[model samples]
Target: MPSEGRTFIEEARRSQIIECAVDVLATEGYARASMARIAQRAGISTGVISYHFGGKQQLLEAVVSEVAKTATDLMMPRILAQTTATGMLRAYFESNLDFMRLHRKPLLALVEVVTYNRGEDDRAPGPYAEQHETSINDVIKLLDRGKSTGEFRDFDSRSMAIAIRGAVDAVPARLLHDPALDLDALAGEFVTLFTLATRRQP
Candidate 1:
């Protein structure tokens, strides 16, 4: 058994490694983010990285889980507080845009993971797929709530969730490829598209 202080220190060190791993992966890509590089970025030794994560894949998974938790932590409260579906949907898009702007590195890593796994079996039990599903479920629940309140048209929430998510994901890709793209203008377009798609008929 470890001393309480030592346990806390170890956990802190592990957290530091996890954070550094994300940075390294984002900057260097998964294929090049070696334990040594991650430790160098963390100001720790390779042994420490190995002690905490056991290997690269484990560290990548932890990074994915951390990124997903961070995204949820940022958005879930606003989502839970909304009394109307339209409000919830607006909050959802705004939160995603805000998150992408503030957390660019993790979002970049997320994009990389999605592109890498584009057509693969995403059903496998892993952090990437798990995070994807969590985000989708959150949107679906909000849509269902909106429909229940007669705020949105009665459409399949799951399909609508996919469309909304696709738009959110595509924004980053477009911005990445074209640095001159105006995100504010794109966001306005997104809002218009979302409203038009979900707006209830008169």
Candidate 2:
């Protein structure tokens, strides 16, 4: 039982450090979000962060995972609640923008990390690349489902998926510039635009 207690405490500490890192990344950008800065934000020594995560890169990776999970948690329910492709598409755009509205900081941190974090081989960060590809594939599958169900017009699923994902992905940068931008308006516009693009004309 003692060991279990220690493990639980460690998990909580790790969560605290990750949350601090997210704030530092969101506010300072990736280039400036050094481990020491994150440590100071967490009110802990850098050694503690290093002990939990081997280095800055790992911590940033964890930040990406955490933010993505949070987004999924918020979005999947909305998406699943819909019964039609059009409804699902609407929910997808609405929920995504709503997430940005509710959790701007974590999304900004994720953008920073994905934009700047590179591996030792100078490759793009693995987590973002993998997650992005999976996102696209998920959209493609959704589009195909609509097609199979005769709910959507005939179009290239992959292309439409890419376009949809691109539209959603562009929001983070826009938010950085226009913090007060009407995301609800934007969300409605996206739903209208993509729904028209994909839905079969009766």
Candidate 3:
């Protein structure tokens, strides 16, 4: 029943609400990011948020999907363009750290979402599961490419992928817990460790 302009405005408003929710979730964890708080932060009515996203769970899902998509879009091209496995792996770590630094709020929210449901059934058909699987698959693909080029050692790419993922996942917690931690230095160390782990030995 709305006009085109009105629909576009509504969509924009919804996007704003989702972003605000992400900020709240990142700063105040998911449990504290209530509908009222998010609406207040977005400068929108709670009813509007409810109308658009149904409830907090749906809004959280939307936020997760948006953040994950943004990260994948930003990193995938850099990863694909690398000419060597080492170069690709370096690109992956650097791009990931840069994304985390630039998009701290949403990235923190993503970490919270991940940690909050760590032991849950990650294989379930949902946005969280899909995002997790996509991340693992991307890393696996990179490892496979590396192995194909003889740049990486002959090992289970899947297990190596999980280890790489674990390192990336651990960074956010370290940063949050110790603001003085040198992330750049840590990233270099991580890249070195990853290279050592996958390097083809003589």
Candidate 4:
């Protein structure tokens, strides 16, 4: 049981360090969030970070994965709760905005990391990196389903899906500039806009 307890403790410390990293990155931006800052936030020595993650790059990847997992876990159930394709698509926007509203800090940090943080080669986060498109793909699936069911018109589901994801993603920067930005109103607008764009006219 000693080994099991040690493993559990290590996992706990990793989680703590990742959470602190998210907070630091979110509040201070990528350039300012160093290993020492994250360690200080977690109340651990810098060596603990090295022992657990080896360096900042690994920790940044962990932070990205954690936030992506969070968005999936939070939004998937809501998206699936609706039966109709339009309803599913609407749920995607609403649930995503709700998540952004609730988990602004970690998500903002996530955006900064993917957009600004570069590997040793200095490349932007690769296609294999950053926020996965599972959620957006799910929206595309809903559009395809609606089209199959004669509920939506044919007009490039893939393009529309990308547009929809882009719309909500632009919110974080807006919120940064104006913390009081009405995300709910914007979500509602997107829901209505996309619904009309995808739906067949009666």
Which candidate has the top score in TM-score? 2
- 28-104 in candidate 4: lDDT tens per residue? 98888999998999998999999988888888888888888888899889888888888888888888888888999
Candidate 1 lDDT for residue 87: 73
**lDDT of candidate 1 over 1-202, digit per residue (tens):** 3434458778788789988877876778766678888889999899888887777667777777878778878987976787777877877877777777789898877666555533224555545776778778878988888788888898988999999988987887886788667766776778778888998999
Put down candidate 2 lDDT per residue, 80-135, tens digits, no spaces: 99898889999999999999999999999989877776655585455587788889
- Show the colliding residue pairs in model 4: none
Per-residue lDDT for 60-120 in model 3, tens only? 7888888987887888898889889889999999889878888888888887776664332
Ten residues in a row with the worst lDDT in model 1?
Answer: 117-126
Task: Give the TM-score of each candidate.
Answer: 0.85, 0.92, 0.87, 0.89
For candidate 4, the 10 contiguous residues with the lowest summed lDDT are 123-132
Please give the lDDT score at residue 27 for candidate 4: 87
Q: Which regions of candidate 1 deviate over 4 angstroms?
A: 1-6, 117-126
For residue 70, model 1's alpha carbon misses the true position, in angstroms, by 1.9
Off by over 4 Å in 4: 1-6, 124-130
Q: Measured by TM-score, how close is model 4 to the native structure?
A: 0.89
- Badly placed stretches (over 4 Å) of model 2 are 1-6, 124-126
Q: Which is better, 1 or 3, measured by TM-score? A: 3
